[model samples]
Target: MAQGDMRDRPRHAGAGDRQMTALDPRAMRLANAETVLRALYGADALSQAAIATATGLSRRTVELILVDLEAEGWVRVRSTEPHASGRGRPARQYAFRSEVGVVLGIDIAHDRSTVAAADLRGRTLHTAVVPMPGEPERAERLAGTRRAVAEALRAVGVRPGQVGSVSVATPGNVNDKGAVDVELSMHGWTGVRLAEEFAPDFAVPVHVENNAKLAVLAELWEGATPGADHLLWLMLEGQYNGMGIVMDGVPYRGVDGAAGEIFWAKGLGLDALTASPLIGLGRLEPEERRAEATAILERAERGDPAALSEVDSFADVLARGLSALSWVFAPRYVVLGGWLAWALGDLLATRVAARMARNAPPFVAVRRSTLGPDAVVRGAIRAALDRYEWTAARPLAPERRPSPVDGG
Candidate 1:
């Protein structure tokens, strides 16, 4: 990764502050090591001095951490490339081990699901998409998800035991207890214990989160707003109008994990508009509504006035929903994602921004996601990868330990 790529990481609010939490002596050392590893992962390759500078650790401390990391096969020395400064000997470079283990990300959408495998460096190695059956039974749908994720992982040469961790992003509110509570608007999904269901089947640590939250994670990790401190993500799709907020590089899961479900706001009355013929109809089995919407977009792109009018109406509904959210959170940057992001393009961002600006503070910036359709899955993979690092550091955590049947 180049320095430019590092810029994509979320900016730390206070560089000099002791950002790492205080723990017992041993845990603190492990935490410091983890921080050093994260710096190496973010930089792709960094010199000892660079790591020390970036992490606010002394050169000796960074060197010791790197030594332990290398011994543990978590990091590797890449090269001794000389700098152009031409004042001293070439400096050694280090990076996270690219092939140490594999992480899987599963994005479960209403109509389809995506699975991707990536390394710690966030490089996507493979991806697969499967059509989601319109089954109303929650068990049946979850079974299908299991099979889809299994098949995708197998195709990418990832065995169940080899998967370091897995993250699943769904269209619901996930509470701290790992219970999914929000209504999924989709065919099947409500009150699901995603972690419990998937954990036994995959035999790996499972982390479940709302899809919009994962999208924000993807943006903060490697997308357009990598270094943004406060971000609001809006995912406009046929089935659900999802939103997520990130503050100081961490997701702000509001009380009951519904921080950004602004579409349900009473006064805005957006639930009715979101469920209107212009949006909700697209979720039908035949997908004819989607075809119609696509046709309208195509005509609008060709400068057809009638199609443009319909598109404008759709954009207006989206803007209205966003306006409500802006009034509540007032995030620094808002990112647009999901299927509509690809279908609507700049028009979506432009119209949403215009509406939000009417109600937002002057400093807010709105932009479309550069991560495209892979945003959720990539975010899942990133989440899984982070869990892997944490697990390696502290395998005794209840969440990290394997089930009894798996020989924990």
Candidate 2:
């Protein structure tokens, strides 16, 4: 837990062209709902005719879909005068509702777990963290995560049932069963069923994602590099080293959701560095280990000979590993994150960038994470928030409005 850090489609169908009557009711309903949603999403507000033009549906059909969306609390209907004027009655416009409910974000890490309760629009209502036990089992970790979630909700005076969705970010890989396949070498963490841990208790959908990947999500959503299609997120906490890939603004989870497990790049993360003779760095006490990295970085910053030596050694290894990865993926931007990024700071970034510059042509930029330690958890929150967006963006059933009467 670093600390709280700073901020920052559709087919067209004509009304009387015979396509409407030939279309299936279910699909037409879904398509109309989508058109209405697109009209609202694409604009601040859209009248039925505006939506009709954008969707190629009749104004009455747009009205029917608007009724359904409003009924489901997905849109807010407002009566306003048409821009063209000459209307005896105000025309109705629709706007997407942003505050339908809240989503839960949980970050379960090697040291601690945090839970954040936020509105659908990604506004944080409350958040809390619980320290993980020195030795935790499947049940204990789940219990701890649940406690944090409960506390977060309670802090905000919300109920479990009110949560629309949940996303969990952890140090391990998410397996098919929704359990995180934590590296066996990790301390106090192993076979943990992240989905079962929360799913049984909460009716909302539960999503388990790698912390680094989640951090990448956070960055892609809001960070220094926004909307970069090709990105590489490197998570280098002393305990773990991995990469998260975002292809075209979407996470590239492999067939088994292990695409970011780049730690195996030339056996760098096959096992803890303790197993490697070159590094010769063994796992110290959690506090000592964390402090040691910070101290080494501090000394390096001051140009200490020994600290500089160690930093150079680590940088060599990282450069080699990153170079190998870059040769393959060739990401546009590589964002350094996790505790190691915080400890090493710009020194590490510059070092890595210099090494990567050797690759030539299509140089991948190296930058420090703006979200800091909260990146992964915030990304989890983002995952939860995405559910709301997806659900709302989807098509829904709508009533078929009566045909308009033509005045000859």
Candidate 3:
């Protein structure tokens, strides 16, 4: 492992570990050791007997594996308490070490950016939001993002060297190479290489992803659409507007990372209908367009004639677009996100379902995003943790298995 850099190295693989081939008996032993570590991860510690019962292994086998893992610094012996009988040796307790390092998640909006730090276990340690210069250059946005991340790391008592990985959510087409090849929200941000800028600052692996796509990923991971393997996230209102498609529980960013740029395809003559209702609301306040849009929807929900007409027209166009996309993707769930979704959730949901239900498939369920505005950031954090896992414990692959002995 590289010194002070956990980005590309395993957390517990030491120099003393013998290289074990697939045929080596040590391979299975390593696998069993991983099982024990997983059992301990859910709880503070586990007794040898408990681990053996949980792993379906004998007490002696559990003891041997713990001995090896303890030597490897992956597990620590907490205590050896004697049984109440007093004649027998104390039961051995072991715990998985979770404080090896931290990860960072950065979410960039058109006018603002947020930074968060979390441990490998996905527990948030610190978070901060900082304003970005309006319509700034790419370098200026990067500088602001870096400053916010530094503040978060410092608040969490972590240094750049301690961050195992960093994930950034931006409004753009993030290609497979992890670069923001096309950023719509950040001016002069095309071809923003995430690793090139962040590697020098944090010395950790960096991931740049589409904000809408990350929100969908977050929803699938641990949000409203859990187990909704096929999903279409229609961000109803956002500063950086777009859609995010997910197939089989994974984001679909297209061949050129522009799969969900459907927002650009204006249709159904929605501009004249959805636009005029909120004409006077902004009153020279160009920034209040989104908020005014939300207010129009709210009034429509209350059966106001003008507002209702405008909102129904918007929903008509929205359903038309959704119908076309549904014919192509056939998602199981449609997650309505962004501030508009938050402001007028059930109202807009009911309206859209009523309109699009006939054209779309029957299995597709539409719902509002429960994580609200934090969805993208949460997904970015999960992505960062996944990066850490790739380096820290990919071989063990604990998440692939369920613990035999479980403790909350």
Candidate 4:
């Protein structure tokens, strides 16, 4: 992991803290509760005995923690089933109450916007997409996104008070506090404080991230490469060519969160190695571009010379950048995402792979993203869930208490 990301992770109690907490009964119980909660958060309903075994805590301690969690609306009894032998009282299965709250993910773009609501477990419950008819200023764009989020929550019968966290994925360099440091695609978006802008509606923690970086997180958390520690996600869509890097399972956000802003290749004197062909398609309207790009790729798949030539040119630029990144990051896998990659399928991947064979690392594998246009929104949802867990749900120590309002 990068040094910055490693430093941001929740640290374990050192030996001295462990010794201190072990002597404090309250601290010890808090620690035990956190452990038990972690075990249940992502798992299916488990019996008290199972939780005890999994956490290495005594049955009594596990029982106490579950009771407290249930009272706090963190857990609930899922069902009671007869024992295998059908003797004595039945076992009551306990499960984390994922329905206690929802997280909102908003993906804002120049052409369209998407909003999704997900449960504690990161499963999306509802989603709504709105097409921006023309170039919109920041206010109009933000209003559209807000309406979409409201529609999504209403579709799922979720109230604003029930939302625990909100994450926004926008085209920009995001700072540590979820502020957009630099943005150019949308008007009046350069200095927007997205978190603050949306805080009044949800009144919960809001997270902001660069769309490319969130796309990388989405692939890591739920897409093609689940356990990959080091990978790169390259988005070749419209005028939004960018890259997201993960090293050692942590995002490599630069000092200013501009680590993977590969879209500025032209500024680096790499004009020939830019995603121009894809950008050309971006000149048309959003819906028109999608259809045109899809038709072109479909024709390329059928061996149309002109369409194939365009694909080849685009693949060359992508390969050049991927080769450079692979040498620098040594990523285990390179994921091609965005509308263009989704339409091109393996045709682009095969071409890029062939080009990189002589220049890039031999062990690097190139793959096409299956998430397509939904990658950013899905990524935003994952980010919201992860941030909520790290900052709100799990208490750092007994000294800190989870937030009642946020339903931590």
TM-score to true structure, per model: 0.79, 0.77, 0.78, 0.84
For model 3, residues 210-312, the per-residue Cα lDDT tens digits are 8888888777767787756688887655333578888876778779677887656666333342354433232122656756765876677778998877756
Every candidate's lDDT: 0.71, 0.68, 0.69, 0.75
What local lDDT score does residue 406 receive in model 1, on the 0 to 100 scale? 15
In model 1, how large is the Cα lDDT of residue 266?
Answer: 57
| Residue 63 lDDT (model 2) | 83
Which residue runs does candidate 4 get wrong by more than 4 Å?
A: 1-28, 79-90, 267-295, 389-408
Span of ten consecutive residues with least summed lDDT in model 2: 1-10
Model 2 reaches what TM-score against the true structure?
0.77
* Per-residue accuracy of model 1 over 1-408 as CA lDDT, tens digit each: 224454323223233323433535565676677678667756668999999998899999898888887877777788788878987889999986656666778888776777777655556666667776665467666766777777766665556766777899998888876668876476546788888888776556789988888888888877888867888887766556777798876888889788877657657655655544446323442567666777777787898998878767776776776666666677789888876676678876787788777867777888998988788887887777656644253222222222211110
**Number of residue pairs clashing in candidate 3, backbone atoms closer than 3 angstroms, sequence gap of 3 or more or interchain:** 2
**Candidate 3: lDDT of 141?**
84
TM-score of 3: 0.78
Segments in model 3 whose C-alpha atoms lie over 4 Å from true places: 1-20, 23-35, 38-61, 67-99, 264-285, 288-291, 294-298, 390-408
Candidate with maximal TM-score: 4
Ranked candidates, highest lDDT first: 4, 1, 3, 2
Specify the poorest-scoring 10-residue window by lDDT in model 4.
Answer: 399-408
User: Lowest-scoring 10 consecutive residues by lDDT in candidate 3?
Assistant: 399-408
